[model samples]
Target: MAAKTNPGRFFEDYATGQVIHHAVPRTVKMGERALYHMLYPARHALYSSDQFAQACGLPFSPLDDMVAFHVVFGKTVPDVSLNAVANLGYAEGRWITPVWPGDTLRSVSEVIGTKQNSNGKTGVVWVRTRGLNQHDEVVLEYVRWVMVRKRDAGAEVAATVVPELAQVVPTKDLVIPKGLDFTNYDFTLAGEPHRWGDYEIGETIDHVDGVTVEEAEHMLATRLWQNTSKVHFDTSARPDGSRLIYGGHVISLARALSFNGLANAQMVVGLNAGAHANPCLAGDTVRAWSEVLDKAETAAPGVGAIRLRLVATKGGAPFALRDESGKYLPEVLLDLDYWALMPI
Candidate 1:
């Protein structure tokens, strides 16, 4: 039998119904909140001002849901998808609760299904991962699939069954975070009155701007999120001794960058999927590009729904991400899909 796999690769020396619990529990802090402000230019008074949030009846401005998701999801990359050929998709994703600063976050993934591809050299694995806060409440949960390479091309094929998944989560499945009472939601500070009705299908936005990340900024972010993966810090750990920038840093930066074009998207309604197309290191200037995929009207009087593709990359130019190989060049960091709420 082949030896155990490397830190992040999949090996045939595995079994079905396995459960992989990733290591490293993290705690969020003020540095993360500061970066969220700088990155997204998120004008939500609740997130930007503790006093404002308190006046609005919140104890404090909690981390944005997407930020929480990014922090939680980043932990799973090494153990789950480092060797993935393609990230198939997501289903049954929900943010069950809020993640406040100072909360510790950890993740656990249960292998829901596994199958061998007819091509013989590869297979697909499906997992349901949950993010729990320090309180042990499920803050986020999602089902995802990845195309993984097989250790032995000639290994006996187990099965070829593909699991069924919903293209979009049902409306009832949308778990609005507990204690999220938008009744007191401050519309003026939220930046726009546009709600679920104003966006037109196929609209395009140019969230114009970029921010160059520095060692200090990335390290601060990684530490705040409690993501202790040494590659993100402790530069002396690597052979070249370079620190790897945290992926959540880039995601927040890009989402914040999206504000230029998507200023009206006040609330995130759904997350269809996302990707870290490439690794980003410190000193890279990041910028963003957005394309509206679809739109719908919402029940919120002034709110509308807009599906958007948000892409981020390093210096050179906005929208210039891939090389001739059709691969995400070194500078490209993220490609994400999601739904946002805007004013009509």
Candidate 2:
């Protein structure tokens, strides 16, 4: 008799254009938000206070954007990256709508491209995944590629066909949550007075705070999202005997640290691109900084979009991203480019 068990998909199992509907939709609530804040220093006013969100024109506070992302991404791990070597990168991501407490979130992914590595041991799979609300509304969507291991190391894969992806989501494509009017925005309460017009391209702001990653905190956050990546939970998976911190955790950490300078950079509307430049492990002190890339005016009244380059480092000098040869320094943990909304 065949033993009844489940072994997740391997690299050769994927075909370009294949659609995968992930299982187990999650109904997010304030408890997840509370735990997220407890894990990271996430204190954006719009996500923290109903009164503040209402003043900015939302009926009530919404779940933190990163929290929603984690829930959606978590659902796809089993089906997509269960045997992955690495989560490579993200691109062309946008937050379509706000996710509130009690919103049931689900994820669907389509394999857009595949390319086998020369080593014959691994291949890259690119999936465009979306998080949908209960009503079938797309709350968020993005393209991410993962390096996956092959069950048969010498297995042949389809010819390399990497899909063409955008480097930056155009500003016009940035979605504003319904009824979100920042015209009457209260800068006093939002924690910073910098509006969209205040920032200049090439300006850099060093977020002068750091958080030491703790083992328990990362474990709790990873488990909360139901993420079962071995590198994040099993120290035995790596040679150094340290569980690698989830990349999304570092994203939230850097975003939270940006509050010191970008407190009013309210809602994250678009994720243009991101990279986990290096692995983060517990005991590393993470710090952040941001550079103004560009700005654009949106049709929404009193709302504008600002493009930013956010960098996270573990004990590296601020504004230092690359070494002499332009390779990312070992101390650089993340490099993210995104669009955020702010009052005009």
Candidate 3:
């Protein structure tokens, strides 16, 4: 009899136009918010205090945006990247709705493109994934590509199909959560005095705090999100005897650390593009910096959108992202472009 155990899909298993419904829906709650704060240096007041969230016109404190992202992302690991060599990049992401406490989330992914690497041992798969709440509403969506090993080195896939993706999530498409009014936002309690108008395009801010990633913490975070990828858990997955740190961990760290200067950039509404520039390992001290990219006026009461280039690095000089060749520097761990809501 064939083994009943599930062996995750290999590179050749994916096909363009295929839709996959990931298993295991998760019901997020206050405990997720608590554990998220404990895992990272998250201090955004809108996500930290129900009273503060209510004052800003939300019903109550919603789960941190990354919290919703991680939970939704975790459900897709087994089906998408359990056998992946590396997650390449993200594009065209947007948070369509706020995931409130008690919201049950699930994920659906459609294989949009695929290409066989010249190496013959691996291939790239591009998928557009959407995270939906219990009410069948899409809360988040993004496009990500990953490198996966071929089950058979001699296997041949269909004609290569590469997708043309947007370089950024257009400002007009950025979604502002319902009833989000930041006119009455309190700067003092929010922990920073900087507002939307205070930031100028082309300006950069170096968030001067660093957090060293611990082996235990990364593992805990991986389990918390139920990311069952072998590369992050099994040291033997790679030739070197080291476990890879999850890229989302670095993203949250960078976003949390940005609080030093971007405290009032409270809610993340859109993700333009992102790349895991390097593989992060344990014991690496992660630091962050942000450059103001663009800004737009939103229709929400006293609300505006600010676009920023948030970079996470390991001991790299501030504002240094790529070398002259346009390749990410070795010290650069992440390069993320996203839009956030702030009080004008």
**Most accurate candidate by lDDT:** 3
Evaluate model 3: give its TM-score. 0.99
Taken over the whole model, the C-alpha lDDT of each candidate is 0.68, 0.93, 0.94
lDDT string for model 1 (210-258, tens) is 7888888777666555555556666675557766676667767877777
Question: TM-score of every model?
Answer: 0.71, 0.98, 0.99
Model 3, 1-344: lDDT tens digits are 98998889999999999999999999998899889999999999999999999999999988999998999899999999999999999999999999999999999999999999999999999999999999999999999999999999898786789999999889899999999999899999999898999999999999999999999999999999999999999999878988789999999999999999999999998888999999999999999999999999999999999999999999868999889999999999999999999999
| Top-TM-score candidate index | 3
Off by over 4 Å in 3: none
**Candidate 2 lDDT tens digits, 1-344:** 99687578899999998999999999999998999898888888999999999987889999999988999999999999988989999999999989999999999999999999988999999999999999999999999999998999877777787999999999878899988889888888888888899999999999999999988889998899999888888889888897799999899999999999999898998999999999999999999999999999988889989999999999878999999999999999999999999899
Candidate order by decreasing lDDT? 3, 2, 1
Worst 10 residues of 2 by lDDT: 152-161
Better candidate number, 1 or 2, judged by TM-score? 2
